[model samples]
Target chain A: MFSYCSDPETLSGLTWLSCYLTTGKHTSLYLSFGTVLLLLAITAPIALVFGFGGASAARSRFVPLSWLGKAYIGIVRGVPDIAFFLFFVIALDQAFEYLRHTIKCPDWDQPIRQGNDFVVCAAAKLPLGDAPQWVHETYGFFLAVLTFSIIFGAFAANVLYGAMQAVPRAQVETAEAYGMTHRQAFWRIMVPQMWVYALPGLSNLWMVLIKATPLLFLLGVEDIVYWARELGGTKTPKFTDYPHGDWRMWYFGALLVFYLLFTKVSEVVLGRIMRRLTHGQATMGGEAQRKAAA
Target chain B: MSCWDTVADYALRSVGIGERLLPRSDFTLCQQVTLIGSGMIWNIYFGTIALLSGFFLATALAMAKAAHSPLLRKPAEWFIFVFRGSPLFIQFFFAYFLFLSLKNVFPVFSPLTSAWAGALVVLFFNTSAYSAEIFYGAMQSIPKGDIEAADAYGMSGWPRFRRIIWPTMLRLAWPAYTNEAIFLFHATALVFFSGFPATQQMGDALYYANYFADKTFNPFIPYPILACYFILLTLTVIKLFGIVNQRLNRHLPQLQRGRIRLRPMLVR
Candidate 1:
């Protein structure tokens, strides 16, 4: 921020905006993009792992395990994912504290749910009752990531499950004939082959994941949407610098552009990847490859 | 109040037919269930109506996208891109705010701030774009043989489209459209959370569930109830769509009647 930013009387347009956008709070806004990326970076893999596990379990020879996996995937399919996001945050928070409560205060049982109160023992509080502000924010964000992963994991499971099935039955048979065990056949043959099929669905899911990041504000995380609203809200000339007209439309418009560009780039990259993946495979893409080679 | 009393007071609460205030103290299982169940009316209303109406628009848009003219195709392409590329959550907020500004321009449209009209408009456009994309994909994959046969039989333009092209498009698209319907239903829970104000405590299932969660300081009961109601709603949708899908594919031999498989696609 320019030193001229101290007095609004002398401030011009760009100078005022420079001070405004560079404030500590706006810095937080910028980092929140990192937070969104961090969430995608973390949640994408964890959710995929859960999805792969769920898909495998669904395909398992064990009837009960398959049933459990199917139920996990199906349950989320019915409910609105936002509902799940809302439910799981508090539900997970309570579950964590409830476990902590039981362990930490074994004898102090004054009823955890006491008439409109969710009273855990003092020591059982998440981040402890005296933890720093950052810990609280981090915990809320962690819970949000968990909730997102769980819901999207179910979707990923459905996608991955289909992809796994789409892998040719003859390929597995070949693995079996080659003396590979069922588990070995699964990992060595089926898993690797499934990626080409899974990539399309996973890329779609990743876009959905990107779009869903704004829901982080709903979960009370100080994500980009939150910062946008905060920074764009009405302010008198009294509070800091860079006073202006209602610019929330502009802020959100910028977010819209950011998301659009990101998705566009993803589409291009995924298209190239699909082309590469299809090369020399025994599918439609492979036929295209043959034609190109000829 | 007893459970029966709670049911009587709030069972139809979301439609403004019952209950003055939501139960405050001594929250019973009945209060939670009945209130949340009442709230489900809104979700079903938004999902079912938007989708039913969107189906036709989607078909038309899909046709336009498949059209030879760039003029026809361009608008369809942009509509699909704009809706598909953005988060539905932001769309809701953006639409609500945009509509709010419109209400100032014309106070005659004050009701747009309410969920019934505003959210439905958003959901309608949203599903239309998504389903249109699905239909367009299906249209592209319409069996070339069937179209060629239609052409050979001297069927051209509207007649050809009505008898050959349209039927094949619907048949191929129904499976994906069913998936889209389910996603739209799930996405409907977002209406109340967005900028639309749920007047007189008249909100969707998720809204009531959140209310209960906040009131009881325990999410254990209400949210799952919401989920149960939704799962039931989802099953009902699948059942109904499966019947339509069956009817669409009635010409097929029994072996060729493909079972409806649900795939997860982002709703809007």
Candidate 2:
């Protein structure tokens, strides 16, 4: 922040606005955008990995493994995902703390749940009771990422499973005829080819995933929605240099435009990717490309 | 309290009709089930009413998007884009605040500030946009031959659409619209979580489930109970839609009747 920020009351118009925007809280608000992007960056790959595993397990010859995968994939279909989010954040936290409590405080003779409170040993607390603020924040964020990955993983599994099935049987058979093992054929033929089929679903999931980031506020993260509400409320000039009356609509309006632009960009990029993936392939898209070229 | 007594007291609790204070300690399974089931009334109210009203708006919007006039098409396109592109969570916040702002401007908008009116309006618009896009896609894919056949018979405009195009569009769009309905039901759980205060503890299933979770310090029970209720609600929606779908395609041959497949796609 500028030295001019020291006497913000004297400044008016753009000068006051500039200083206000540079405040520590606003900086945090700006950084939270990075947090949203980081979450998307981290969760997408992790969810894809989870999806791949789930899809494979669903297709496994082992009945129990297949059942596990089927249940994992089907669970999200039944429950509202926000319910899963709220449930998992608390449930996973308690589960972790409970595990740590059993391990770390084996001799402590106290019921963990005592009349509406989950009382864990101090040491068993996630990020510990003495841990720094950032540690707790990071721990909460990590849990959120995990929850997002788990829920979105099921959706991605649905997409990938369908994509894997869409791969022609003959392609895998040809890989087998070339003396490749089942695993090798799967890796070479099925996995590589499924992307083209999965792109549409995956892109849609990406858009949904983007939209769901605002729910991070519900998960108790200091994300954009939290900041928008906090900073956009009526603040008197007595308390602050630059006071504003209920500007939450403007803040949320900005967020709306941001999301709209993001989705538009994503659509363009996904379209290009789809075209690239389809080129010189056996699908109708590729055939059309070939026809156009001829 | 006895289970029967508890049920009698809290059966309609979510709508402010029954018990004033929820059960504190000694939370029984019966209490959880009965209370959560009571809360489900709001979910059913929001979902069915929103979907029923949104269906008509969505049909009109879909036709507008598919219309030849740019004026109609552009607004329709933007309406879908604005609603579809943003998170419903934020939409709820934005709408609640907007309604509050309007209440200051005019006393007539005061009732719209409440969750029952405000949140329902958001859900209505949200579902309308989603369902419109689905219908628009279906409209685009309506077989050219059918339209050509209608043209050959001199059927045009409203008559052509009413007799031929609309039914086929509905048939084609039914499966996707079913998915949208399910998502809308799920999205209704978000109403209370947003800016809307669940006045007098009259909240939806998630709200009660959240209350139980907060009270018990154990999320394992209440969330699943809510999920079970929702799963049943989802199945019921599918069943009801399936009947309507059957009716929509009654004139078609059995083989050609589009089978309703439940694909749980994106949530708002």
Residue range A150-231, candidate 2, lDDT tens digits: 9999999999999999988999999999999989988888998898899889999999999999999989999999999999
- DockQ for every model comes to 0.65, 0.80
Which docking class does model 2 fall in?
medium
lDDT of 2 at B257: 88
**lDDT per residue (tens digit) for residues A39-109 in model 1:** 99999999999999999999999999999999877766667788878888888999999899999999995
Global lDDT scores for all candidate models: 0.87, 0.92
Give Cα distance to truth, residue A229, candidate 1, Å.
Answer: 2.2
User: Which candidate number would show the highest lDDT if scored against the true structure?
Assistant: 2
- Location of the lowest summed lDDT over 10 successive residues in candidate 1 chain A: A240-249
Give the local distance difference test score of model 2: 0.92
